[model samples]
Target: MMRRVRAKKFLGQHFLEDLGIARRITESLSIPPSHVVEVGPGMGVLTQFLVQREDLDLYLVEIDSESVEYLHQHYPQLSNRIIEGDFLKFDFNKIFPDKFSIIGNFPYNISSQIFFKVFDNRNHVDKVVGMVQREVGRRIASGPGSKEYGILSVLLQSYYTIEYLMTVDEHVFSPPPKVKSGVIRLVRNEVDKLPCDERLFVKVVKAAFQHRRKTMRNSLKYVEFDHGAIMHLPVFDLRPEQMSVEAFQELTKLIEEHPLCE
Candidate 1:
């Protein structure tokens, strides 16, 4: 008899017990699926369905040793594919030399961090379909002018087109989470790279949102300058939340070209 794996709270493991929902999540993958990496796959709920598809070159990343052992024991065919490590640290370039997509019931705690990993390897990660805390999904899919539009929204939006897929109720999991979950998809867009310095772009976005309440003039004080040179620019009057991804890009270019106060 197979022993059931207990959900570890510290790992944010909310095992999706509903098979119907699991099947739906699996089907949500972008059509003509190529290589797919499943993150934090608990009890092979998603793995079971993913393996049924003959075309997908599937890989599983599980940090928990217990789950890894269970998956190995149950799914013998995936002998060398299951990676026993953290998805954040795992090198996508090593395993997938070309392109791949990501799919999972992401641990709510580390979902944001996972998105950051995707951003860093945007060139290789062509698409992503995953379940996350509802609020987090909303923020990721949100465009400018809304409260949910912030750092993650701006950063990822620059490179990918995000879609909020569905809202899932809390009752579907083994140990139900306090909050509902939502599914989202991100497809890599035509913009291969932003015209400005990528590192500077990230720094600018983070700085502005860190002081979101203040208008750009006050928030951008984090960015060193004479303070008077660019103050007359119309963007300086707007708050971080008001600026779009393009606006931030323009600001980054402006800062890059302008002289900084020593």
Candidate 2:
């Protein structure tokens, strides 16, 4: 057996030990396979199965040096595919000139940031299959009106068709996390462009969700939009959590088109 790498607290490394779960996570990738990037592949549990898929050209990006070294010793077939760097800092376009999918057991500390990274590369990222804190997974897959829904729910749902896959118990990890883990997959939709100004759309969504408890009428004040006229609209009465992606899109347009331009 290869020497085990210690789970680093700072890196949020909870190495997944359940092989069945790993296989399930690996197989969750869609058919007609293409380029796949596995982030935070601690100890290569998932990599072991991902390597067998002849259809996929897989690359591993891990921030942990010890885990990376362990992967190097065990998965010699990986060769140059192992990247010793932060996935967030990586300019994936440099390594992946074309489209790709992402899959991994994402670190709890950086999972939200990771999705933001995914959102940045939505044009190239066709799908994402990640295991994260159960709460976060639910939040990503959640729809409007649910308490679990928030900023990420609204932003990511605007682009990807998110699905909550399954849950893994805390005990499944080598160093079990405090909470259960959930798997979620995001499949890109057919929306080439949205009806509203995309930049304003983000601003409106972020602003509204900043105070999720407040109505959009109150919360969106942070964005400095002239709410004088648009506040009369029925949507303003609803809280940020109550608004769907389409509702936010319309809200963005209303804000942009309002005559009170500063």
Candidate 3:
């Protein structure tokens, strides 16, 4: 018989006990047969359903040694697929030579960091389905002109289409988290290349939202730009929250064309 595995506080382990939600999350992945990496599969609640899909080449990345050992004993068939390491630091290029989808009941503490890594590897990652802190999920899937819209909204929206899937109550987990949870899906768009400087686009979006209340003209003062020229541009008058992903791309182009002197 399998012994009960304790949740590790430092690791942010809140194992999902609800099978219905687990099945729903597993079915959220729309990608065809390919590599699939599940992060922090604590106690293998969702893993059980994921492994059922023979089309997917399932792999689990768990940081907790105890949980990893438990998975090894329970799912002996996944001996080579179960990777024991930090998902943030693990090199995906080494594991998958091509694209893959990421799914999990992600750790609430490092949820944002996981998305950042996903964004960084956007080229090799086509789809992502995961559960995160409610606010974080809403923030990522939020569009322009909303209070939740910010850096992540713009950055992620640029390359991927985000969908706020479902809300999960705190009662679903073994040790209920203080806040509610949400599931989100991110599907990569077909933009082969960005119209403007991609790096500068990120910088501009972050700078503008640094003070979300301020208009683009005032918020982007720290960034190198010709204030006089850009002041007349319509985008400069609007707040960061008012601009869409396309608008931000346009703003970056304008700044690059007419740069300010130090």
Candidate 4:
């Protein structure tokens, strides 16, 4: 028998009790999984569907001891698959020797952090299907010139082709979040390596977006590059919000080839 576990506010726990949504979320994983890891499987609402798939070597990582115990008690079939630890700090390389997909009704507070971890391990993580705050989903999948477009927009879109799958109603969760949720799918693109320095590309994108109101020429002035040469480029005339991922890549190359000092 399953036992009731209170959602911890500190952890931003909002259990998805709606089985229909759970089924949809699970079915969204189209990959023939060698391995899969579900983050924060609170109360096993989504786990119930994931464990049914014989193809996937499914694993659950939950932080709450009470919820972990409940999962073990209720879903004995999971057996040793349930890991009690922080998903952000867990060593995924040790778990899945090769590639794997990540899925979850992610904790809203740490959703961005979770994505940053995913970005760091993009080579091995081929696909990601997860729920996040609608605003975040829009921001990630937003394109150039959109007000929603910002840091996550350029960074994640640089390597992955993102799709905003659907909007989930707030009432579906046990303790419904104030904002509606959105499901998004991220598929890795064919670009193995970037045209410019990866570190410098990130720095440029972050610096460009720091002051959205300013033009790239003004916003990127402090980025340790040749202002005189960069100022001549037509791209500088555009605001950070107006620049595409490809445009940023080009800017990175410009900075690399034409350093004012050194």
Candidate 2: pairs in clash? none
For residue 176, model 3's alpha carbon misses the true position, in angstroms, by 0.4
TM-score of each: 0.96, 0.97, 0.97, 0.97
Candidate 2 stretches with Cα past 4 Å from truth are none
Which tens-of-lDDT digit does each residue in 30-82 have in candidate 2? Answer: 75768999999999999999999988999999998889899999999887999
**Candidates' C-alpha lDDT:** 0.90, 0.90, 0.92, 0.89
lDDT of 3 at 210: 92
lDDT of 3 by residue, 1-262 (tens): 6787899878888989999999999999967899999999989998999888988999999999999999999889999999999999999989899999999999988999999999889899899999999999999999987999989888888889999999999999989999999999999999867899999998999899998999998888888878777678777789999998999999899899888776
Give the Å shift of residue 21 in candidate 3: 0.8
Give the local distance difference test score of model 3. 0.92
Q: Which ten residues in a row have the lowest lDDT in candidate 1?
A: 222-231
Model 4's TM-score against the true structure: 0.97
Cα RMSD to native, each candidate?
1.4, 1.2, 1.2, 1.2
Give the better candidate number (3 or 4) by lDDT.
3
As for candidate 1, its clashing pairs are: none
Q: Name the regions of candidate 1 deviating beyond 4 angstroms.
A: none
Give lDDT tens digits, candidate 4, residues 1-262: 6659999989989989889989999898888746889999989888888888987888999989999999999889887899998999989988788889999989898999999888889888888999999999999999998999998889899889999999999899889999999999998898888999999998998898889999988888898877876587788889988998998998899899888776
Candidate 1 per-residue lDDT, tens place, 129-179, comes to 999999999999998899888999999999999999899999998789999
Worst 10 residues of 3 by lDDT: 225-234
